[model samples]
Target: MKQLLVFIRKEFYHVFRDRRTLLILFGLPTAQILLFGFALSSEVKNINLAVVDFAHDQATQHIIGKLQASRYFHLQQAPLSYAAMETAFRQGKIKAALVFPANFSADLGHTGRGQLQIVADGSDPNTASTITTYLTAIVGDYQRQLNQAAGALPFQIVPETRLLYNPEMNGSLNFIPGVLALVLMIVCTTLTSVSIVREKERGTMEVLLVSPFRPLLVLIAKAVPYLVLSLLDFTLILLLSVFVLDVEIRGSVMLLYGVSTVFIVACLSLGLLISNVTASQQVAMLVSMMGMMLPTLLFTGFMFPLENLPGPLRLIPNLLPSHWYYLVVKAVMLKGLGFGAVWRETLILLGMSVALLGISLRNFNIRLA
Candidate 1:
């Protein structure tokens, strides 16, 4: 028993001595708690809402003011015309829009009834559903308040809620894009990193480097097979999504594949960067899983509304390639958006792939020396 106790104490000392071990033991759990606590919220806040009040009447202005003051929404600069509102939605500027027809207040005053059109972006069904419900509740509350005051007539504000992009609100639509991002990243990054590390472990990597071929060419050659394999994986996922899940690729199939190729290249480049930095398979897996995988899972907006996250945490998703890829997939697959809608996201992914590949090649040069 005494010997066992001494051995346990020695093991504890060894654990504390290794910074990486200490981090895995303590830091990882703490970080998970902080991130999950903030990021996994169901209650969506800070919704960007656009209001078009054609009535310019007291009742319409009052409701707009209430929406502006509500914790749930940030009333965007009111779009002047229907054309402007459509433009905002297409550009992904606002999550929901409210439109009050002309003579809105007069109809409410005389007939004790009113009509309001509420338009929600339904690409993310959950957020769209929640915002519509919340907005309806707010409008209902105003009607209730009027009825309670001065023994007024029963006032009714009927909201005609229309869900754009996904009228049926099929939950599958939301997860398909997210799954593509998650699966491709995990498979490509883990497989590529593990494969390269395996080469290093088996001593073949040094053999390949010693050849007369350029180091960059060798690196690309090593990555090429995995790149092709990852694309095949993507193809399989797309087929499953289309047939099994019945989620149609609304945009051009060529455009979808084109954007996905960019994303896959970015993920492959990331894996190369990981392989170059880590000497062992264990370290590479840890970095790939804990470092790359966690960010991809958490920062990708499909898992939750980005608005729920705090200010500093919000910036994390912007830095992640998976997040951008997820957005591009949603725009193309769900919204039927053309390349014009997704050019910015595609450009960013292309830039990241180039930068990561460049760095990995530089690291290989240093290793060769």
Candidate 2:
């Protein structure tokens, strides 16, 4: 018990003494939470829109008034020609353009139909899709109101929408869990790798090796402190996501924590393997940045859709622990799934932890011999 306490104390000292590691462990999580919550949002707001109104009628003016008042779109340009609309979009001044055909109100009044073309910049598919949906709903609602005022039209199509799981479509609920996984990877893996290599650089690892403690014991001693710290950081992140960001965990909290624990173990083991392979602190830092951090960020479907990535790039996430963690987090947080829903991911994380531990042990023994 005394030896364990001493080991833990030493580990804490190492962790706290380095300002960079401490900041990455605690500061980075909060930064990422705020960034993804506010700055990096998929929700569209204040989008600039252009109008090419060939039909300068009272009805068209009324429709444009409703659009400008709705607050989702801003009427940035009222172009006289399609060429002007094209120029505005090409200059990145507007996201969408609405064109009202000539004699729009005359056609609607006589034949009960009119043509309105909406041309969107398809370069950003997400923004375009959202804008399209919003426009459709607004137009449909306006048409229904007009019909009701005109004594009930013969044609009526009622559309009922039911959003599954995330009824509110809160992006934070999806984003927070992914950010948690990413921050934990940086904290556990990069920091651990650097800490272990620091020991080698300072000539402390050799001294510890000469002691009676086994290599496995030393490894555990180093990792256990980080595990505790990670759990504490996890709780902080969870609380911030819930109370501050208004993100909810639909599944059992205990189950989420259990899966998170498995993921942290896997990440820490990978860090340990990295520590064993690298000889110096600089090499460890470089390897952690290049080998683990880049792959974890790019391939984990955090910022970009995995399906949109090329085949070769898609295969890269298969080898990353963050990819598995993202799946588990999405299941628990967004889908309200339990252990049964994410058993495969949990097993993959466990298998990865075991494999990394085995490799680290083999390397440690070889170095000892």
Candidate 3:
């Protein structure tokens, strides 16, 4: 019994001595709680909405005021024409737009009937559906209030909804892009992160460093195989998504692959950086999987509505490469957008690839202790 107690004490000392183990014990739980509490929420808020009130009357203004006052949306002055509104949707300026006819108040007062056009960006069918539901409720509430004020009159404001990009509101279309991001991150980052670390475990890394090949070539050689493999994995995922899931790619296939290739590179570079910093294969694997998986899941915006996150928490997703990749895929595969639509996200992924690769190369030690 005394010997067993001594052994337990020794184990505790070893755990506290290792910073990584200590972190895994205490820090991991704390971080998970904070991330899940703050970021993982289905209750939507701060939807980017545009209001076009051609009527510009007292009634229209009151409804607009209520929309902005609610926690659900932040309102913008909508574009003048339908074409401009379409441009706004494509540019991701507004998630949904409410268009009121010029004779809105006049019709509601005299005839107790008016039409409202609710246009939503439907690439993300879930968010689009939620936005439409919220708008319907708000309009219904206003209609009920008007009826009460007018006494026995049924004052109705009807909302006519149109969903752009995905009129059908397919559920699979919403998640496929996110699944792509998660799969690529796992295959590319987790696998590549352990490549160099495995060499250290087997004591073969020193031989590669001393050989005729340059350090850069050695790193490239380690990454090239995974890069090709990740692309193949992406292609396979795309095929299954199209045939099995019935969510077809709407944009150029070449462009989709082009952007996916960039994202894979970014993920690979991140993995290489992990391999460079970590001392052991086990540590590398843990960091690459646990450290990365949470961010990928939370920050990618596929798992939950990012707008629901608090202001400071919202900025964290922009740091994740998967988030950009998800956006690009949605624009290309789901929205049928061209290179012009996804160029910004593509550039961001490319920049992340460059930066991560550069840092990995800089920190890579030629002389390992």
Candidate 4:
């Protein structure tokens, strides 16, 4: 029993002596609590909207003016045609479109009723649904004002809400892409971290360090297998999502895979960075799980909307690789968007991959020195 106690004390002493391990051991849960507490929110605000006023009448103008007054929406464009509205939506400019038919004023004046068409880009079903509700409330308020002025029965505004893309509003469709993000996080960070640290623990890393190959080459070779494996895992998840889960991939599969490749590279690079800083497999695993997985789950806007989070917290998600990757996946998979639709997100992921890889290589060199 004394021998066992001594062994346990020695283990604790070793863990405490490694400053990085100690920091990770204490920092992970604190960070997770704070991140999850602050960042995960469901509210929507500041949605972009477009207007098409065919009537060009007082009532149409009044409705449009009311929408502009609301904090919930920002009027981005006034396109002349529905085609233009569709183009804007496909290009990811506007979330919703408000169309007033030619007879808007005439119908309202004659029958105490008006018709408004609310078209929402249903790629993001939650945001689209919220925008529709907001517009409906705003239009209803306008109708009430009309009735109050005339001292008559309540006027009615019929909202024809069209949800483009995802008319069904399937929750699973959104969830599957996020699941991919989590899987990638595990593969790139957790697996790679463990693999590299295992090599170090077994003295294989020391052997490679003395070999002719550069440290960067060794790190890259270590990452390539995981990169390929992560892609394979992504493909498997995608197939299962499509077949078993019945989630459709609306965009170009090739583009989705291409962007996914970039994200995988970024995540693997992040793992390399972790492995460089950590000396033990246990420490590497802890850092990867807590540092990478927790943030990917909470801060990436996978399960929660970043718009709803507090102002400073909103900026944090932008720095996470999974946030941009999830955006790209969601836009392409749900909206059927192509490269043109998601160039910004793709570029961000590409930039992150390069930056992280460069930093990891630098850290590797420093450790060698």
Candidate 5:
């Protein structure tokens, strides 16, 4: 027990003594949380909307008034023509354009119907979809109110939307889990890889291997401390996400921890594999950044939606552990799903961990051989 405590203490000393490792362990979580919470959000607010009202009538004025009243859109410019609207959008001054035809009021008054063209920049499809929905809802509500006043329709088509899990649909709630997975991967994998390769670079790995302690035991001792630290980091992130950002975990906390544990193991095993294969710390760092970090960021649906990606790019997420982790996070945090709901993802992570461990162990044996 004393020896184990001493080993753990040594691990802590090594971690604290190196400023870079300490920064990666502690600083990264805080920075990532702040970044995701503030900078990275899917919810669009105050979107610049250009309006071209050729109608020049009360009906068009009313519609524009309603649009400006809604907080989702900010009326930026009143362009005269479609060309001007297109130019404004191209220049990135506006995200969407509202065009009211010249005969809007006359047609609506005489024929009970008119057309309003909404041209949205489809470059960011998600934002475009959201803005379109908001505009439709507002216009529909206004139409319904007008119909009610005229007693033309007995029944109304009220939008009955039941948002599953996350009723508020806060993007932070959706992002927190992914960020947690990413931060843990970066810390655990990078730390383990660097630590192992540092020993190799310092010519101490051979000395340690030749010592009385078993190699596997030494590996376990080195890794166990990091496992504990990763858990600590996970807990801190979870707490901050919930209390600070108002992100809730609708599913069981135990389930989240369980899934996260498997993912962490897989990530750490990958680091071990890299550490065993690479001869220097620089190589390990480069390999991890190129092989793990880039793939995880691009394919895991962290910054971009998987659905928006092309077919070939979509398949890439299947190869990454972070993709599965992101799904688990979304299910638990946003969908409020139980174990049964995320069983497939959990199994995938488990399988990945087992496979990585097996590969890492084989490589360790090869190194010994």
Candidate 6:
């Protein structure tokens, strides 16, 4: 009994002696809880909206005023043409566009009806769809207001909602792409982090550092085996998602794989960054879990919709590599989108990979120096 007690005390002492390990152990739960608690919201807010009102009438102006007054939407300058609106969406300047057709007031007064168009950016189908829903509800409210004032329901506003790409909403189809992202993140970040730290703990890292191999070559050699294994895992995931789960890939398979390859390299670079900072396998494991797993799963739109997150909290996912990967995967897999549709996200991931790899290599060189 005394021996067991003594061993347990010794283990606790060893664990507490490492300041990095101690910080992670104590800080992880607090940080994760705060982050997830604040970031996860059921309400969507701060949607950027553009209005194209060809009607130029009281009714159209009133509707535009209401949209601007709403807390959910931030109205931009009215677009002069459809081309301008498309450019805005492609440039990510707006999530939705409200178009009031010519003689909107005339149609409403004479025919008791008018057409309102809601064009949403389908790159993020979930967010775009939600924006349309909100616009529809607003128009309905306006119609109800007219009926109450006139003492009869005389006017109707018809909303033509065009959800580009994902005309048919499939929840499973959306999730399958996200699953690929999460799996790759786990394979690359967690496993590579632990393996690299294992070398450090085993004193093998010192021998490698002293050897004739260049630092970049040494890091690349260590990463090659893991990269191949991660690719194999990615292939298996793709097959399972398509066959067993019955999720169809509508886009170019080569494009999907190409984007995934870049993301894996980014995740691997992130792991190397963690491994470089950590001294032990245990610290690496904790850092990978606390830093990579929680944020990627909860905040990266992998398991939760980004639209539902709080306003300030929404910015965090943009920094995560998995966030862009999730967007690209969903766009390609569910929508059959080509490279042109997802080039922005692809470029962002590529940039993240290059930046993280550079930082990791610099840190490695410093450590050796």
List model 5 lDDT by residue over 102-131, tens digit each.
898888778777788888989999989988
Q: Report, for every candidate in turn, its global Cα lDDT versus the true structure.
A: 0.75, 0.81, 0.76, 0.76, 0.82, 0.76
Error of 3 at 62 (Å): 41
lDDT of 2: 0.81
Candidates ranked by lDDT = 5, 2, 3, 4, 6, 1
RMSD of each: 15.9, 3.6, 15.7, 15.6, 4.0, 15.2
Q: How many clashes does the backbone of model 2 have?
A: 0
Q: Across residues 301-331, which tens digit of lDDT does each residue of candidate 1 receive?
A: 8877889999899998988889999999899
List pairs with backbone clashes in candidate 4: none
Cα error, residue 290 of model 6, in Å, equals 1.4
Extract clashing residue pairs from model 1.
none
lDDT of 2 at 333: 78
lDDT of candidate 3 over 1-369, digit per residue (tens): 453444345434544576764454344433433343344434456899988879999889888987987777888777898888888889999999999999998998787677888989899898889888888878776776777777775544434333422234455566667767877787678767776787777877787667655667667766666666567667766776666556778999999888888888888888888988887888998998898888988888987789999989999999998999999998998899999988988999899988987887888887785
Model 1's TM-score against the true structure: 0.57
Writing each residue's lDDT as its tens digit, candidate 6 over 1-369 gives: 453444345434544575653444334333433333234433456899999999898998889888888888999988999999999989999989999889788988887778888999888787777788888878876887776777655444434443421324334455566666766776678767776777778887788678654556656765765576567767776676666555678999999889999999998998899988898888888898788888888977757678998889989988999989999988998889999999999999999999998898788753544
- Model 5, residue pairs in steric clash: none
Tell me each candidate's TM-score: 0.57, 0.83, 0.57, 0.56, 0.81, 0.55
The sequence of per-residue lDDT tens digits that candidate 2 reaches over residues 1-369 is 678779989899878897987888889998889888977877776789887899999878878887898667899859899988999999999999888999888998988887798888899998898887766666666776678788667576634222311236776666777787788887788888888888888988888889877677788888999899898889989988888888777888898888889888888887888988888888888887788777777788877778999778778887877889889888887789988989999898778877877777677642434
Which portions of model 1 miss their true places by more than 4 Å?
A: 1-167, 365-369
Scored by Cα lDDT, where does model 6 land?
Answer: 0.76
**Worst ten-residue run, lDDT, model 6?**
162-171
Task: Let me know the TM-score candidate 6 reaches against the reference structure.
Answer: 0.55
For TM-score, the strongest prediction is 2
Ranking by TM-score: 2, 5, 3, 1, 4, 6
> Which candidate comes out best when scored by lDDT?
5
> Model 4 over residues 1-369: C-alpha lDDT tens digits?
453444345444544576754444334333433343334324455788999999998888888888888776889968889888989999989989998999989988887667879999898898788788878878877776777787766434434343422234454566556767877787678767777787788887777778665666667566766676677777777776667556778999999899989999888888988988898999998999899888888888767777798878888988988889999999998889889988998899899999998887777742445
lDDT of 3 at 216: 73
For candidate 2, the TM-score is 0.83
